[model samples]
Target: MNAPDRFELFLLQDGEKKITEKIFTGLSNTSDFILLKEDHTLGNLIAEHLKQAPHVLLAAYKIAHPNVPEVMIRVQTDGTITPRDALRQTCQTLVQMYFALGREFQKEFALRQFADQGDQGGAGNAGGQGGPY
Candidate 1:
Protein backbone atom coordinates (compact mmCIF):
# COMPACT_ATOMS: atom_id res chain seq x y z
CA MET A 1 0.00 0.00 0.00
CA ASN A 2 1.47 3.29 -1.18
CA ALA A 3 0.67 6.50 0.66
CA PRO A 4 1.58 10.09 -0.02
CA ASP A 5 4.53 10.46 2.37
CA ARG A 6 8.23 11.03 2.60
CA PHE A 7 8.53 7.74 4.51
CA GLU A 8 6.96 4.32 4.06
CA LEU A 9 7.33 1.15 6.15
CA PHE A 10 7.40 -2.30 4.60
CA LEU A 11 7.74 -5.88 5.75
CA LEU A 12 8.72 -9.02 3.89
CA GLN A 13 8.46 -12.68 4.78
CA ASP A 14 9.67 -15.84 3.03
CA GLY A 15 9.62 -19.33 4.56
CA GLU A 16 11.59 -18.80 7.76
CA LYS A 17 12.92 -15.35 6.80
CA LYS A 18 11.28 -12.09 7.74
CA ILE A 19 12.47 -8.55 7.22
CA THR A 20 11.15 -5.04 7.75
CA GLU A 21 12.04 -1.82 5.95
CA LYS A 22 11.04 1.79 6.43
CA ILE A 23 11.60 4.22 3.60
CA PHE A 24 11.54 8.00 3.67
CA THR A 25 12.33 10.78 1.28
CA GLY A 26 13.79 13.27 3.75
CA LEU A 27 14.72 13.25 7.42
CA SER A 28 12.62 16.14 8.70
CA ASN A 29 9.07 14.92 8.66
CA THR A 30 6.75 12.16 9.75
CA SER A 31 5.13 9.79 7.26
CA ASP A 32 3.21 6.58 7.03
CA PHE A 33 4.97 3.29 7.80
CA ILE A 34 3.43 0.79 5.39
CA LEU A 35 3.81 -2.93 5.88
CA LEU A 36 4.70 -4.40 2.52
CA LYS A 37 5.00 -7.97 1.26
CA GLU A 38 5.36 -11.06 3.42
CA ASP A 39 8.91 -12.50 3.20
CA HIS A 40 12.31 -11.34 1.95
CA THR A 41 15.73 -10.12 3.06
CA LEU A 42 15.77 -6.61 4.64
CA GLY A 43 18.92 -5.46 2.88
CA ASN A 44 17.17 -3.18 0.38
CA LEU A 45 15.20 -1.17 2.92
CA ILE A 46 18.26 -0.53 5.11
CA ALA A 47 20.19 0.66 2.07
CA GLU A 48 17.40 2.98 0.96
CA HIS A 49 17.02 4.67 4.34
CA LEU A 50 20.77 5.31 4.59
CA LYS A 51 20.86 6.63 1.06
CA GLN A 52 18.12 9.20 1.58
CA ALA A 53 19.01 10.41 5.09
CA PRO A 54 22.59 11.56 4.41
CA HIS A 55 21.87 13.44 1.19
CA VAL A 56 19.04 15.11 2.98
CA LEU A 57 19.18 16.01 6.68
CA LEU A 58 21.92 13.64 7.80
CA ALA A 59 24.75 15.04 5.71
CA ALA A 60 23.66 18.60 6.27
CA TYR A 61 23.80 18.10 10.04
CA LYS A 62 27.22 16.45 10.08
CA ILE A 63 28.68 19.89 9.55
CA ALA A 64 25.92 22.18 10.80
CA HIS A 65 25.37 20.77 14.28
CA PRO A 66 28.03 18.35 15.48
CA ASN A 67 27.49 18.77 19.20
CA VAL A 68 24.98 16.61 21.04
CA PRO A 69 24.77 18.54 24.34
CA GLU A 70 24.12 21.87 22.65
CA VAL A 71 21.53 20.29 20.46
CA MET A 72 19.83 18.68 23.43
CA ILE A 73 19.69 21.92 25.37
CA ARG A 74 18.54 23.87 22.33
CA VAL A 75 15.76 21.40 21.71
CA GLN A 76 14.56 21.66 25.26
CA THR A 77 14.92 25.41 25.67
CA ASP A 78 14.21 26.50 22.14
CA GLY A 79 16.84 29.09 22.83
CA THR A 80 19.06 31.10 20.51
CA ILE A 81 20.41 28.30 18.33
CA THR A 82 21.42 29.22 14.80
CA PRO A 83 19.05 28.09 12.06
CA ARG A 84 21.48 25.61 10.51
CA ASP A 85 22.51 24.28 13.89
CA ALA A 86 18.90 23.98 14.99
CA LEU A 87 17.89 22.14 11.87
CA ARG A 88 20.86 19.80 12.05
CA GLN A 89 20.34 19.06 15.71
CA THR A 90 16.63 18.60 15.23
CA CYS A 91 17.09 16.16 12.40
CA GLN A 92 19.68 14.11 14.27
CA THR A 93 17.62 14.05 17.44
CA LEU A 94 14.49 13.11 15.57
CA VAL A 95 16.19 10.18 13.86
CA GLN A 96 17.67 9.08 17.19
CA MET A 97 14.33 9.33 18.96
CA TYR A 98 12.62 7.35 16.24
CA PHE A 99 15.19 4.60 16.60
CA ALA A 100 14.83 4.58 20.38
CA LEU A 101 11.11 4.08 19.89
CA GLY A 102 11.94 0.94 17.94
CA ARG A 103 10.45 2.39 14.81
CA GLU A 104 11.48 1.43 11.27
CA PHE A 105 14.14 4.16 11.43
CA GLN A 106 16.09 2.02 13.88
CA LYS A 107 17.72 -0.11 11.22
CA GLU A 108 19.06 2.88 9.31
CA PHE A 109 20.37 4.59 12.43
CA ALA A 110 21.95 1.37 13.69
CA LEU A 111 23.66 0.78 10.39
CA ARG A 112 24.97 4.33 10.16
CA GLN A 113 26.38 4.26 13.68
CA PHE A 114 27.99 0.91 13.00
CA ALA A 115 29.72 2.35 9.95
CA ASP A 116 30.77 5.45 11.86
CA GLN A 117 32.29 3.37 14.65
CA GLY A 118 34.24 1.39 12.10
CA ASP A 119 35.51 4.57 10.53
CA GLN A 120 36.74 5.71 13.95
CA GLY A 121 39.27 2.84 13.62
CA GLY A 122 38.45 1.38 17.01
CA ALA A 123 39.54 4.56 18.75
CA GLY A 124 37.04 4.72 21.63
CA ASN A 125 35.58 1.24 21.96
CA ALA A 126 36.53 1.07 25.61
CA GLY A 127 33.72 1.87 28.01
CA GLY A 128 33.80 3.67 31.39
CA GLN A 129 37.00 2.92 33.27
CA GLY A 130 35.02 2.86 36.50
CA GLY A 131 32.93 -0.03 35.32
CA PRO A 132 33.77 -3.67 34.74
CA TYR A 133 33.67 -5.04 31.19
Candidate 2:
Protein backbone atom coordinates (compact mmCIF):
# COMPACT_ATOMS: atom_id res chain seq x y z
CA MET A 1 0.00 0.00 0.00
CA ASN A 2 1.18 3.54 -0.81
CA ALA A 3 -0.14 7.06 -0.65
CA PRO A 4 -2.03 8.26 -3.69
CA ASP A 5 -0.22 10.54 -6.11
CA ARG A 6 -1.61 14.01 -6.66
CA PHE A 7 -3.06 13.03 -10.04
CA GLU A 8 -4.26 9.72 -8.66
CA LEU A 9 -5.83 11.43 -5.66
CA PHE A 10 -8.64 12.74 -7.84
CA LEU A 11 -9.03 10.14 -10.55
CA LEU A 12 -7.87 6.86 -9.06
CA GLN A 13 -8.47 6.88 -5.30
CA ASP A 14 -11.28 5.24 -3.39
CA GLY A 15 -11.59 7.55 -0.40
CA GLU A 16 -8.55 6.84 1.80
CA LYS A 17 -7.59 3.70 -0.08
CA LYS A 18 -4.43 4.23 -2.03
CA ILE A 19 -2.86 2.47 -4.99
CA THR A 20 -1.92 -1.12 -4.23
CA GLU A 21 1.35 -2.61 -5.45
CA LYS A 22 2.17 -6.30 -5.57
CA ILE A 23 5.20 -8.21 -6.68
CA PHE A 24 4.31 -11.17 -8.83
CA THR A 25 5.82 -14.58 -8.26
CA GLY A 26 8.11 -16.51 -10.65
CA LEU A 27 9.04 -13.39 -12.54
CA SER A 28 12.51 -11.91 -12.13
CA ASN A 29 12.67 -8.20 -11.52
CA THR A 30 8.97 -7.94 -12.21
CA SER A 31 6.25 -6.43 -10.11
CA ASP A 32 2.61 -5.50 -10.52
CA PHE A 33 1.10 -2.22 -9.42
CA ILE A 34 -2.65 -2.04 -9.01
CA LEU A 35 -4.07 1.41 -9.56
CA LEU A 36 -7.60 1.53 -8.28
CA LYS A 37 -10.17 3.63 -10.12
CA GLU A 38 -7.61 4.37 -12.80
CA ASP A 39 -7.79 4.08 -16.58
CA HIS A 40 -5.79 3.46 -19.73
CA THR A 41 -4.41 6.99 -20.04
CA LEU A 42 -2.42 6.94 -16.80
CA GLY A 43 -1.45 3.33 -17.27
CA ASN A 44 -0.19 3.95 -20.81
CA LEU A 45 1.69 7.03 -19.73
CA ILE A 46 3.48 5.17 -16.95
CA ALA A 47 4.26 2.22 -19.18
CA GLU A 48 5.67 4.49 -21.88
CA HIS A 49 7.92 6.18 -19.36
CA LEU A 50 9.12 2.86 -17.98
CA LYS A 51 9.82 1.59 -21.47
CA GLN A 52 11.91 4.68 -22.08
CA ALA A 53 13.90 4.15 -18.91
CA PRO A 54 17.32 2.64 -19.41
CA HIS A 55 16.89 0.13 -16.62
CA VAL A 56 13.46 -1.07 -17.62
CA LEU A 57 13.36 -4.21 -19.69
CA LEU A 58 9.62 -4.52 -20.10
CA ALA A 59 6.60 -2.52 -19.06
CA ALA A 60 2.94 -3.18 -19.73
CA TYR A 61 -0.49 -2.82 -18.18
CA LYS A 62 -3.98 -4.27 -18.43
CA ILE A 63 -7.52 -3.66 -17.29
CA ALA A 64 -9.47 -6.83 -16.49
CA HIS A 65 -12.61 -5.09 -17.74
CA PRO A 66 -13.42 -1.76 -19.32
CA ASN A 67 -16.07 -1.01 -16.78
CA VAL A 68 -13.65 -1.68 -13.95
CA PRO A 69 -11.47 1.26 -13.02
CA GLU A 70 -8.56 -0.94 -11.99
CA VAL A 71 -5.28 -0.84 -13.87
CA MET A 72 -2.63 -3.45 -13.28
CA ILE A 73 0.82 -2.43 -14.50
CA ARG A 74 3.62 -4.90 -14.81
CA VAL A 75 7.14 -3.51 -14.75
CA GLN A 76 10.28 -5.49 -15.28
CA THR A 77 13.67 -3.93 -14.98
CA ASP A 78 17.21 -5.07 -15.45
CA GLY A 79 19.09 -5.90 -12.27
CA THR A 80 20.03 -2.26 -12.03
CA ILE A 81 16.76 -1.22 -10.41
CA THR A 82 13.76 -2.80 -8.76
CA PRO A 83 10.42 -2.80 -10.56
CA ARG A 84 8.92 -0.70 -7.79
CA ASP A 85 11.70 1.83 -8.04
CA ALA A 86 11.29 2.03 -11.78
CA LEU A 87 7.61 2.73 -11.40
CA ARG A 88 8.34 5.38 -8.80
CA GLN A 89 10.93 6.96 -11.00
CA THR A 90 8.52 7.01 -13.93
CA CYS A 91 5.92 8.73 -11.80
CA GLN A 92 8.39 11.32 -10.61
CA THR A 93 9.50 11.99 -14.14
CA LEU A 94 5.91 12.36 -15.29
CA VAL A 95 5.22 14.82 -12.48
CA GLN A 96 8.24 16.87 -13.44
CA MET A 97 7.22 16.81 -17.08
CA TYR A 98 3.71 17.95 -16.24
CA PHE A 99 5.00 20.78 -14.11
CA ALA A 100 7.35 21.91 -16.85
CA LEU A 101 4.54 21.66 -19.37
CA GLY A 102 2.26 23.73 -17.20
CA ARG A 103 4.88 26.40 -16.77
CA GLU A 104 5.52 26.54 -20.48
CA PHE A 105 1.80 26.73 -21.17
CA GLN A 106 1.40 29.60 -18.75
CA LYS A 107 4.24 31.44 -20.41
CA GLU A 108 2.72 30.90 -23.84
CA PHE A 109 -0.74 31.89 -22.72
CA ALA A 110 0.67 35.05 -21.15
CA LEU A 111 1.85 36.02 -24.61
CA ARG A 112 -1.71 35.78 -25.93
CA GLN A 113 -0.81 33.94 -29.12
CA PHE A 114 2.02 36.40 -29.71
CA ALA A 115 -0.54 38.97 -30.85
CA ASP A 116 1.85 41.86 -30.26
CA GLN A 117 4.35 40.29 -32.67
CA GLY A 118 1.66 39.95 -35.39
CA ASP A 119 2.08 36.14 -35.36
CA GLN A 120 -1.61 35.47 -34.78
CA GLY A 121 -1.09 31.73 -35.44
CA GLY A 122 -2.30 32.27 -38.97
CA ALA A 123 -5.62 33.46 -40.51
CA GLY A 124 -6.87 34.87 -37.20
CA ASN A 125 -8.24 31.46 -36.17
CA ALA A 126 -5.42 30.73 -33.69
CA GLY A 127 -6.49 27.16 -32.91
CA GLY A 128 -9.75 26.19 -34.49
CA GLN A 129 -11.41 23.16 -36.05
CA GLY A 130 -8.91 23.30 -38.88
CA GLY A 131 -6.17 22.22 -36.51
CA PRO A 132 -5.56 18.79 -35.09
CA TYR A 133 -7.93 17.74 -32.35
Number of the predicted model whose lDDT against the real structure is largest: 2
What C-alpha lDDT values do all the predictions have? 0.34, 0.77
Across 1-133, the per-residue lDDT of candidate 2 in tens digits comes to 6864657424734464446779887688889889887788998989878899889999999989986778899988887989988888889988888887777766666665565457634555453222111
In candidate 2, position 122 carries an lDDT of 51
Single out the weakest 10-residue window by summed lDDT for candidate 2: 124-133
Q: Kindly report which residue stretches of model 2 are placed more than 4 angstroms away from their true locations once superposed.
A: 1-16, 113-133
Error of 1 at 43 (Å): 26
How far out, in Å, is residue 22 in model 2?
1.6
Pairs with backbone N, CA or C atoms under 3 Å apart (clashes), candidate 1: 9-34, 11-36, 12-38, 12-39, 13-38, 13-39, 14-39
